[model samples]
Target: MADLNSLLDDLAAESAELEALVAPLPPEQWARPTPAAGWTIAHQIGHLTWTDEVATLAATDARTGSTDFTELLTEAAPRIATFVDDAAALAAGAPVPELLQRWQDGRAVLAEALRAVPADAKVAWFGPPMRPGSMATARLMETWAHGQDVADALGIRREPTDRLRAVAHIGVRTRDFAYAVRELPPPADEFRVELTAPSGAQWSWGPADAAQRISGSALDFCLLVTQRRHPDDLALQATGKQAMEWLTIAQAFAGPPGTGREAGVFS
Candidate 1:
């Protein structure tokens, strides 16, 4: 497991990488549509900015022993399904320069806020409470996922990096939450997940001899869980019945199951 400081550093690096890709875009390109049907590059950056703001608020509240985040969640519960999209849409309306600066500032604030959280504290979030390290990992996952949208919009291909280790770890850890959101029961047995990282190192989880297994490139697994690509378009392999089913509905991020990309759309 990564310590909070290490995870925060990687989170910043991931954000910086994506920022480099977007920082130079001309105004017209910000309106380019991404793989997400109605969202453009602006929407992608807007979503990240909005999320970082919320995460910063949550972390700060946790640090101060305030109930602000809990109350915010309660207020949002009624609109949970539409709120994420609504927030993204609203943020996307800002001028490109303003949106970009907000994302830059918000993420920096979130990192600082997270670092100040007590080691034993659990911060409130959309899902379960998280330790500061886990919160940083979640932030890293969202940044990378949205970064893919921005990359796709610009027709730019990002090099996969070891930072993906954090994203894949979240993908595997959220297996049960994926099932729950679908109102389906998770499999009774643990499934083995093995992926070859970009550097060709093996990253494995669960019992080595588990009956159900998923194996492939770690990049593909991260893309699958983030719903950035259709499973049929990836190089993943699944053994056993439940494991195969999991490939179809896997989602690493919180919120409703996404309207996943159609197979061959990006093929």
Candidate 2:
């Protein structure tokens, strides 16, 4: 379920975009808090840099990753402090330029590792094993999602790009993952998902005639899945019971079910 090449390209583009934004800012801005509550802009990029290094290790190393990712799902809502959070906090004190360079270097190494692996070979991760392609896609999703927080915090409105197609693809593919993370039995019936891309092209997944359907702008759908924007702020529509339920709790990034932004919380 991964398009490795496109995912990798998008990953580079996204990292570059975020770096460009943070590079010119005054030092104090790096310490400013993003919408993610206590996390500052530096903290978001710090997490990205740490994650890139871990993902590279999993893709190239014989052993999979170090932790049981799903082990934390039970502790989802309140989100107790874990190793990942601690690492990000520690990295937060590094100078902004150093953080940006670290992220750039780590992601380049990850790109090389991903390309060397067999396309269908599974790479070990915290929750489940993913093919190199899927692993790269997951990395792209995390990068873009975190970038959104940085953008919002800096008060910059990024114009949606074709790169979103990769992100939207993951959001659709992770439908079952989202439900599974919450310990709910995924619905037996499949749902149709359709989204209008930035270039005005339509993209979709699932059966065309499924009783359940969700359709809207690709950007809005992406925002919903990444937990960046509450569903109420998007132009999305759901036709059946399952579709409606998924909209309320859907997430593409792994771990526990995220406590999404409250309605009307973000303008």
Give the per-residue lDDT of model 1 (tens digit) for 99-215: 999999998899899999999999899988888999999999999999998888778889999899999999999999999999999999999999999998999999999999999
Q: On residues 4-61, what C-alpha lDDT tens digit does candidate 2 reach at each position?
A: 7877887788888888888888889999899887899999989999888777777765
Stretches > 4 Å off in candidate 2: 1-3, 62-81
Prediction 2 global C-alpha lDDT = 0.83
**Worst lDDT window (10 residues) for model 1?**
253-262
Structural similarity to truth (TM-score) of each candidate: 0.97, 0.91
Clash pairs, candidate 1, are: none
| TM-score, model 2 to reference | 0.91
Top candidate when judged by lDDT against the true structure: 1
- Clash tally, candidates in order: 0, 0
Q: Least accurate stretch of 10 residues (summed lDDT) in model 2?
A: 68-77
